[model samples]
Structures are given as C-alpha cells and as structure tokens.
Target: MSDDLQKELGVVRDEIDAIDAQLLELLNRRARCAQQVGEIKARHGEAGFIYRPEREAQVLRRIQGLNPGPLSNENVTWLFREVMSTCLSLEQPLSVAFLGPLGSFTGSAATKHFGHAARLLPQSSIDDVFREVEAGHAHYAVVPVENSTEGAVGRSMDLLFSTPLKICGEVVLRIHQNLMTREPSLDRVTKVYSHAQSLAQCHEWLNRNLPNVPRISVGSNSQAAELAMQEAGAAAIAGEAAAERFNVPILVANIEDEPNNTTRFVVLGRFDAGISGRDKTSLIMSAPNRTGSLHNLLLPLAEAGVSMTRLESRPARHTLWEYVFFVDIDGHRDEPKVAKALAELQQQAAYLKVLGSYPAAVY
Candidate 1:
C-alpha cells in the first residue's frame, strides 16, 4: 500500500480503538448507576428487582421524544434497553430461560430485555422454560403470550394454570420478517421454511407471490434460516438477526403481510413489586355463576379509576362452567385506590390471586 493510504488506515484503526475504550468506560459508569438504583430499591423491598412494563414503555417514549437523531428512534430505544439490562445485572446475575435452540425470536427477546449481563438458557419447549424457572434453575423465564396475527400462545396460557410462576413484566416486539435464501433469484425458490406464526403472518404475500412453493414449519424463524442456508431452492422468513447469523441473503425484505405485526411476551418470576412511581398489576380471579357477578367485579375497578389494559378468560381447571379472568390493570397494587379496590374485589370474587407487582420495566 502507498504511504498516504497506510497513514489513513492507521488513523481509522486508532479512532476505532479509542471509541471502543470510551464505550467500555461509559458502560461501566452505567453499571455502577444501576447498582445504586438496585440498592435504593432493595432498601425498600425485595420486589425492586423485577421489571415492570408501563415504566419501560414510558421510558421508550421519553427517549424518542428527546432524541436529536444521529441514531434513529429504534436505535436509541435499543441502546436504553441494553443499558437497563446491564444495570439489572449489577444487582444480581440472573439466569433467564426462553424457548429456543438459540437464535430464536424468544432468545432475541430474552437477550434484548435482559441485556448483555444475564445468563440465557435456551429450551426447546415453552413448558421447559416454565420448568426451568419452577425448578429453581433459572431466575426467570420468558414466553410468548400473543401475536397480532395468529392470537394467543395457547401453551403459555395453559402452563400458567399448572405452574406457580407469576407474570412479572411484558415485552412487545415489532415483527419484521424477510424472505431470505442462498438462491439469488425468486424464480429459483421452490420451497419456504419458517415458524408457523411467520407463515401465517405472510399468508397473503406467499400465496400472491409464490403460490406453488411448498411451506414448511419449523420451531423458529431462525431455525428456518439455518435450514435455508444449507438447502438449495429454499427460503426462510425471519428477522434481521437471523439473516446476519446465517449469512443468507435477504431476497425479499419485510414480507410479513401486516406492517403492524407484533408479538407480546411475558416475563415469569417469583419477585414481587418494588415501588416504581408508575406501574401496573396483573390479577387472576373468578366470579360467581350468577349474572351481576362480572359487573360487580368490574365496578370497583372503574370506581377506583384504574384502567384495565387486558382481560382474557380461561376455563377454570377441573370446572366445567367456571372461568378465570386474567386482568392487566394500570396501577400498582400497593397504591391506595388499587388496594381499596382489591379489598372490595375480594368480597365479590369466588377466588382472587394478587400476582406480584414490580418496578415497571424501564427502557
């Protein structure tokens, strides 16, 4: 290389190294701040350790609102999520198990939520994540709850009945899927591989564009990408992470039929709530068989000025007619009005369980 080119290369390499050192220092400072926050939380209660969703959403909005945009909105949100993850680690090293054979969306979700600090355990089955948490091998577990396209993850809801673990926080990941393959041309593609949900979300696109191509379901979109990397005439529908991991080319990007497609995931753990000025609480209850029972249950919440975010009914285990309602409400259980409402609710419900309240997850 010429002397001028070599000088330019040396300057770039030195600049990169300097940036790395600065990043390391910034990360350490962030970790220390997190430790202090954890200590403050612990002095109040144990529940301080768990995450809360409302806080996280609020943080994300605030970050976007203040961003000057050398980095995009998404980039800022991701950076904060990583900071939160690292901060949480300083309090204690947590092991979180999620549905995965690695590189699955669940794995990505777990890592994104936990940051670079937590030990992640990948399990093949959703039930296995529950099992690992239940057996004390993991501090927490993450499982898919609902998808914008296909609806609830039935197995996760069913497992909720069988396990003692409580939902600690929720994560909603925007789904962006791409058609990727080694085959360079769309004409060369004869088969598709992806998770069932991915296929369902892209149903219209697949039928309209590649009607004759056979679709095969796999455990995850990442797994499909792996298969595509090894097979000719095959393509996978998955996220950008999978594409980078598998080194496969994205033949068609954002193939998911719905632009607003998203998947909601829930965190399961034993920790209770630490007071976050803003928070939400989840409750499971069953009302009496008679008519005014459901109304009676909701009236107190309305009177308390609590907004109900989610309400879904599951068949009460071993009971033909009874149904349990899983509710997500906007306020901490410890709040004066919420406590009063729960007290009133206890009188009207056949069964009531107060799931743990934690510091709302913050971005």
Candidate 2:
C-alpha cells in the first residue's frame, strides 16, 4: 500500500510489458523466417516434409545449454517447443495419431512431443494408431512402449514387430496418477477402474487404501475416467489431465507405488530420424536357437565400443517359444562404429531389424 512500493511495482510491470512487445516482434520475425524456410524446401520439391526431429532436438538442446535464466531449463525448452510448433503449423499443419479416447498418457506424450498446434487424432487402440500413420492418414503416431514401474507394454511391443513405420522420436513422461471420481467421497466407491499398467503401477497404494474395491482394467485411463463419470460408485485412476478433461474431482493424488513412475513413448513415422549428436538406436534381433547364440549377438556391440542401454525379449509371434530381442544402444546407426557393429550383428543373427536412430529425449 506504500506509494514508493506501488511506483516500483508499476515501473517493473511497464518494463515487463515493453520486453513482451519486443518478444512478440522477435517471435513474428522468427515465424517469417520459418515460412521462408518452408518455401525454400518446397522449391526443392520437398513439400510435406516440414518436421525434422534431429534439427529440432539440436535447437532445443542448444537453447537449454545457452539459457541464462530465472526460468528452469525445462520451462525454457517447453516455451520454444510451442513457438516451433506454431511456426511449423503456419507452414503446414501436421496430423498426429495416438491411442486414446482423449486424455490418455499416450495422448499427453503426443502433445508434449508434437505440441498443441498439430492436430491430434485419438485412436481406439495402439494398432489403430499405427494403421492411421501407415495409411498416411496421419503424419505420425505416438504409442506407449514401456513404463519404469510396470515394464513394457506388450501390445505396443507386439505391434512394433510388424509395423513398417520407424521411430522418429521418443518422449519420457513422469506419471502422477490420481484417484478421481464424480462422487464426493471414497466411502461410496465400490469399484476402481484404470488401464492395466496404471492399476499395476498403483497396486500397492490401491491395496493399502481401497482394499475391498474391485479393480477393473480397461483399454485406457481415459476410458476408465469416462466410466467413472457414468457410474456413481466407480472411481478411476488416471493423470490430472484426465480429471480436467472429464470434469471429475480428484479424490487422492500421487497414488502410484513408485513416486518416480514414468512411461516411455515412441513417435512413429514413415522415415527414420537422422543423427543428432546425442542419439539412441533401437533394433530387434533374433538369434538362432542355440547355446551361446545370445552372447554372440552382443559381442559385436561391445567390441565396437557401443554401449547398450537396454535389452528386452519378446516372443516371436509367428513361431511358438521363439524369442526376439529388442535392444536400445547409445549411438546412431549411421555412425561408423555403430554401422560396423550392426553389420556384424546382422550377419550373425538369424534376423535383424533396425527400428530407428532418433535423438534421445532432451530431458
């Protein structure tokens, strides 16, 4: 209420307003440059190829590195993401598909990776998401691959084996599940619903709190939230976004067993991403069913000085009891050492498929 304090606050506000004007001018200038870039690409007959994951990754990384700020690096990168998304949309709007009824974590990952400027199409199933992109109905698709707590999404892994689309990018979303319902109190709740992965993620918490409630696994957390909206005695476990989307109230928050629960999602597109300095490659390989076949498959990567980040096995769908391995390595396939290793592994393995070499998640 002091005059001096009021004057100081007014002055600061005026300065902020002035800086915002400058930022607006600069943003428009940047958008105009983006438009020019699109026109140049079209002139070279490269129309409909506006997005470049490697390039965007480089830009975001550089921005984060150079950031001198009161705002955190994640916040800075997110602002730039929206800016780029908007500029890209001005050039040509992109259509992205995700497994959803809307408000699913996969949908959130798609938005996080692609931004709100892109049109989002929610599919009924993961297979539908892949089919949408494969049929050219969508430029890209986002699908959940794995979770830190509950492990790999079996359906997504199975679909990846058959889908011709490559992984162009990846998003890692930290999940915070909440118990939500339309009802006012948990005392009235009789049934709990959520995606199987989510239910598993919150298994311990559910057992501790809603011990007597029957837990039902649904296709998506969004679908579960929808059901909660309809049924009086039903509660759904999902993210905060789903609560807002469905106009449901949160009964409890952070109910997952692990506080650091996260889900990894992959963006699928027709072409693989080019090398970004910090990149990761995903591949599927099957070794001949023989002793030492598995060990021999990994030797080349170690010999080539490539570090393996993750390895998982899934049943080869066509042949019963046969297993295929999915591996994530810490380098692009085009790198000299990586190429050498992959070539050696290809010859040694019964089958090999390079899923993609994409920029690693920035954060």
Candidate 3:
C-alpha cells in the first residue's frame, strides 16, 4: 500500500473514532435527561403518561422532515426509534401482546412500532391478545385490521366492535410471503400450509407454481411453518422471519400475488391517543332501519367537508340482519369540523361509538 493512501485511511478512521465517542457521550446525556423526565412525572403523579404516542409521533415526524441525508430518512427514524425505545424503557418497560406463536406479521408490527426494548407476549388468537390487555396483563395489544391485497381481517374487525380498548396507534407492514419447506426439493412437496389470508394472498402464485399440491389453511403462518418443519413433504407460505425462526429453507421468495402487499395493524390500549397533527378517527355507527337512513347518516359528513377514508360493514351480534358500519375519517374527533359531522351523524344513527383517534402511520 502507498504511504499517502495509508495516511488518508488512518485520518478517516481517527475522525470516525472521534465521532463515535461523541455520539456515545450524547446518547448517555440523553438517557440521563429521560430519567430526569420520569422522576418529574412521578412527582406530579403522572407516571402513566410517560409513553405518549402523540408526542412520539411528532418527534419521529419532525426528525424525518429535518433529516439531510447520506442516510435515508427511514434509516434515521429507525435509529431514533431504538434510542427512544431504550429511553422509554428506563421509565418503564412496556408489556405488549400480539397474535402469535411468534414470527407472525402481527408480532413483527408490534416490534416495529414498540421497538425491541419492549416485552412482547405472544397470544394464540386475536381474542386472546385483547383479553391479555383487558385483564391488565399487557399494556397494549397489536392485531392486524386489514391487508392491502386480501382486505379486512374479519376476526379482528369483530373483536374491535366488542373490546372496550381504544385504538392508540397504527403500523403498516409490507409483507413478503415466501414458500418454505424442510425438504431439499420443491418437487417432493405434496401439501402447502399457511394462514388463510396468506394462502389467499399467494393464491395465484401457488396455483401457477405448485399446481397439483393441496393447500391447507391454518391458524397462523408461524404455526404453518412449525408444521412444515416437522413434515417432509409439506411447504408453508410465511414471511422470512417465520422461516428463520423455524429453521426452514426457502423454496421460493416473493410468492404473494401482489408485489406491494401490506398489512395494517392497530395498537389497542386502555386510553385513547391525544391528537397528533396528522390523525385518523375511527368509529362504528348503525343507521336506523329505514329507506334513506344510511344515506342520511353519510350526508352530514360530506356536507361538513370531512373526508372519509374507509367504510366496512360488520354484522351486529345482538340483532339479526342488522349491520354496523365502521368508518375512518381524516381528522381527529376533537377538531371542529369532525366534531360537527360526528354530532350530526349521532343524531341520525341508532347507535354510535367513537373507537379512537390516532396518528396515521408514517409510511
């Protein structure tokens, strides 16, 4: 190596070392500040307010907006997320529950939003996750509400109607389903197993590639991977995390029908999130059984100039042939325009329930 080149490399290494030292010092200083904030909250009898979703959302959004990058905005935000997660844990380590055997997309969503510093509990079913939070065993619960490719998660939607929990936050995860198996060759596979939604998402790919193989719908993709690990001729359609966790070999990657398949998960907690600048309000309403009742219910929102993002109908469990409509609007419920629309709609509807207003997912 040339002497000049060696000298330049040494100089760059020293600069990097100095930067690392500075970063370590700053991080420790920040953690100390976080600890002091916790102490102040305790003194004011507001310790439970340490994890504020609105404040965190504002912080992340501001960081992304101000980022001038060699590193992408996402990379910067992710680093800060972990830093904040660590600082929050210093206040109180959060217990989060998600639908899982582990390695499910719901579990991934929980980790993505809460960070690895949180204590994640895996529940067998969506209902179990809600129960865990409701029973005070968990601080929050994460469950998949909808998928871009396959549409709504019916069980999760139904649970939302009954559970007293509020929607405190949302996370959108890009899903990449893979075909994995224990066998060395795909030619030897005779059966496929996966969650019903996953199987549906990869339906076209499965039909085209494994034409003769029978597909089975299981409870979750993680459970499907578990079965594939134990069986010779079985393949599972799941995310890369499941394959890695279960020690299965990937036979095919990106097997879903859509390249941009994404799932939206909601965080359920005891208290509703305060308004973040960019927010979404979700609610359920059942119109009176009359000719123009549904039309009347929606007319106020449109007249009030509030944009409705989504609407889904679920069967009301107590009343036969009666359906309740779940709606997502573009603003927080406390906003004057939104509040006016909701008030008018309440007068026209037979039932109304404001689920919660929460910050929209940041990409």
Name the candidate that leads on lDDT: 2
Counted clashes in each candidate structure: 5, 0, 0
User: lDDT for each of the candidates?
Assistant: 0.80, 0.89, 0.88
How many pairs of residues collide in model 1? 5
**How does candidate 2 fare on TM-score?**
0.87
What TM-score, computed on C-alpha atoms, does each candidate reach? 0.74, 0.87, 0.88
| Residue-by-residue lDDT tens digits, candidate 3, 1-96 | 999999999999999999999999999999998899899999999989888888888989999999999989889878888999999998899999
Worst 10 residues of 2 by lDDT: 146-155
How well does model 2 score by local distance difference test? 0.89
RMSD values for the candidates in order, in angstroms, are: 4.8, 3.0, 2.9
Judging by TM-score, tell me the better candidate of 1 and 2: 2
- Candidate 3 residue spans exceeding 4 A from truth: 1-8, 39-45, 147-152, 183-191, 211-219, 230-233, 319-321
Scanning candidate 3 in windows of ten residues, the lowest lDDT window is: 146-155
Model 2 misplaced regions, further than 4 Å? 1-6, 147-152, 181-196, 206-235, 242-247, 319-321
